[model samples]
Target: MAVVTTAVRSGLLFPLFLLSIDASFQRKSGTKTQNIGSFWNGSTGRSERGTELSCCALINVQMRQVFPIHAQQTRPKKECRDRLVQYNDQLDAVLGELEHHPEILLRAVVADGQYAKDLFVETVTGHGFALISKLQRNANLNYVYDGPDQQRRGPKRKHDGKVTFADLSRFDVVNESAAERILTQVVWGVRWKRLLRVVVIQVLDHHGQVIKYAVLFSTDITMSASEVVALYRSRFEIEYVFRDGKQFLGLQDAQMRTQQALESHWNLTLLVMNLARLEALRANNGAQTLVFGVEDLKRRAYNALFAQVILVNLGLEARFEELIANPSGPLNFGLKAA
Candidate 1:
């Protein structure tokens, strides 16, 4: 939270922050490891038979830059888990960190369809944040009753009728393209028991027929439909953090069995990635557009370390600056071309 606050204060990051929440499974072994259970392997798109740790993360997305705020293990199931912490409970832990930094302008909390439950939505909205997420295609939704009420009614009518996706004429068409159509309406969610600004995306085929559709909703009814769609799309940026951590930062390489040791390793792995991103942004000096490649950063660091070790071993440390000053020297050996 301090790092995020500093970035916002220093003008490196915008005041608006969109919190993206998701979980990833880390493959682990050994009978002594705690909280190990069958978790969904996103890479393989299936539940792995082997034991794994369910790590949930909160990422702050601003344009192209992603800042990882918190990550911890959550129990995948309540039946066999010793310490049964639900996903919503782990999310509350992440939100607790944000509460300390009230100055940060948080716009909304975006998650996937898995978090579209009433409890999760209430948790996010309770934190004074607008919850934006995907809902089931056939979610139980009803149009808000806008007609005149009866003069002698016992109670006012709340819902008019069930919402039908095939008949979007009642809804407002916000966007249309060759690929899909975006329609929105302020309706009452039966299951959620609240008003929702729902966006229905009707995907089109080559012949312009409706092949399938998706449903996205936000608690903020005043938010525009296009903005909701765009924000939900940006939620995928958090997945990159998990990808880089596992591939380059050894996110699943921990050998520890205890919860504390594993948590420390997970935090350190993501923290290093966050530091690297901050360094990259600092090097760019707040440029509007800058290419950030983690692989290139790793390559440059390796080259610098290799050059420093060879210079010190050869008793040529005095000439290190001159050697590195040369553009074609060892320090620049394997860097990608700009």
Candidate 2:
């Protein structure tokens, strides 16, 4: 919460937040690690034995910054088998935490296809926030009945017919280009048993043939199709948070065995990453777009620390300002050129 307040003061966060919910697996060795369970590792393209962390992150769409608000270790269903540790259950906890911060106006919750289930959708929408997520290409959907109600039937008509991508006569073409065609419609999800704003993107080949396609949906039927697509694309930014936390920070290098210690370590690693990025943004004068290099920041920090040690040992601390002013001084050594 302090970090979020700092971001708000720095003008880095917008009023309308786009929250992303996802999970990442960290491979750990040894039997002493608490809550360690097998999970699917996307980097390896297969399921591996590891611990999973489910995170809810806020994405600054304009600045392209991702800040993790909350994260918790998720145990495999086959092991702990408790509903409280399930994905949707963890999401409820995240939402509950956000409820205390009324200043954060969450516009929508974005996620991938794995979270497109009925419970997840209902959980997000129940909080009065829209949900933008991908749908399986072969999901069962039907066109809403627009004709007259059944005058002689016990129940009212609901579905006109099944929806087919090959025949999009019922959908409106909202966007079109040489590369793809975007169509949208308010259709009924057969599995979810609810109306959804569905968007379909048809990727075109060199000859304009649809070689591939993808389906996206939003719980808010009033949301624009383009906005839904853009929000869903921003969901990928959370993956970068995980990538940086593991590769640059010591997200997976924690030696802690206890659950409390491991959770603290993981959150600290992510918090440090966020702070470093925030410092970079400040140094750049809060530019709308700037290049961020965690490696370069680390190098500068190391150089400064080394210089401080040398200055203190040589009793030249009084001349620190003068020495640092030189372009080729020790304080600037090993620092990346701007």
Candidate 3:
């Protein structure tokens, strides 16, 4: 239901790569809780575990957006953050840093609860992808069924008030392996598109453990249920950005006192990360790129993937020169950097 950011590691700040940071509030927004930790000067080199404002990002091929944008939950953890959309002009300030033209090719986006309702979607769609986000996964959506075309010569159920497109109070949803009927509802998309709503349900197994999931999606993509899962699953990879950033990248150390400093620091961190990923993308594909299990990334190569970003970020032309200079050096760092 809610995702909390875990750490900020050492990497490039992604100016355009979106982050899906989550948190469990240690202090209430309005209930008055004083700052509890020593202003993290990083002398100890770690976040002082307490009330802190931070976030993370995820990337998926199935992501439905072109550029990266940030979306926040309806309620920001800190009231000061509640007006961030207005405060920072809805992240419009960061657009210049991205330097993306046409505003429609933005292949990545970042978001959390505090983000305005459709900020991420708008940004990504502007670029050219359809991004499905978990930040507002359950926000109520409204739409009308698109079974027939508009030109059909018949009484329209929508205009005539005789047809019910979606019923929020009731829905029918089924997961792969379950006998109990799940209670679902219509969650509409921002645009009142005909087929944008979906059916979602949370079911408990025999062990009394609750596994929340959705039945089907209404996006324009005409794929099977597995495809939908695969598409949405890309969101998990971005989630790992939060985990890896907190541990390997310096996301929270953001020692600058000014708000711009913090935002700039976070964005730069993601840029560094994207630089590393661009290298990997030039080399690997699919599972290799998304692989993040500790056992997997812990190998000297994978650790280097997150650790030796400085070397990896070196341009290909420079790398070739280095290879020519020292053939036996660590040019063997990544997986077949051909």
Off by over 4 Å in 1: 50-61, 76-85, 303-338
Give the number of the best model, judged by lDDT. Answer: 2
Q: Is candidate 1 or candidate 3 better by lDDT?
A: 1
Q: Encode model 3's per-residue lDDT on 1-338: one tens digit a residue.
A: 01101111112112223323333222213323233332222335554433344443344343221112342212333434443444234344344433433322234343433442455455545544444434344444544454565777777644212213223234544343442334333334534333342434445576654554434342334434443444444544554554445566665554454445545666676555554454333344422333332223334355445434665676443354454246464444543331
Question: Candidate 2, residues 38-115: lDDT per residue as tens digits?
Answer: 788999999888788788888776665778877778876776775333878878778878888877778889989888
Which candidate would rank higher by TM-score, 2 or 3?
A: 2
Give the Å error, residue 57, model 3: 5.4
Estimated TM-score per prediction?
Answer: 0.87, 0.86, 0.46
The CA root-mean-square deviation of candidate 2, after full C-alpha superposition on the true structure, stands at 3.6
For candidate 1, report its TM-score.
0.87
TM-score of 3: 0.46
Please provide, for model 1 over 1-338, each residue's C-alpha lDDT reduced to its tens digit, 9 standing for 90 to 100. Answer: 66667667778777677877777878887666777767778789998743444344444455556777766666546544433236677777777777877777778888899889877888888888899999886899999988898788589988889998878889998888999999999999999789999999999998988899989999999999998998898888888777888888898898987778888898888788777877877766752565555777898788877877888999987887886578666665666674
Q: List the residue pairs that clash in candidate 1.
A: none
lDDT of 1 at 56: 43
Which of 1 and 2 is the better model by lDDT?
2
Instruction: Give the worst 10-residue stretch by lDDT in candidate 2.
Output: 329-338
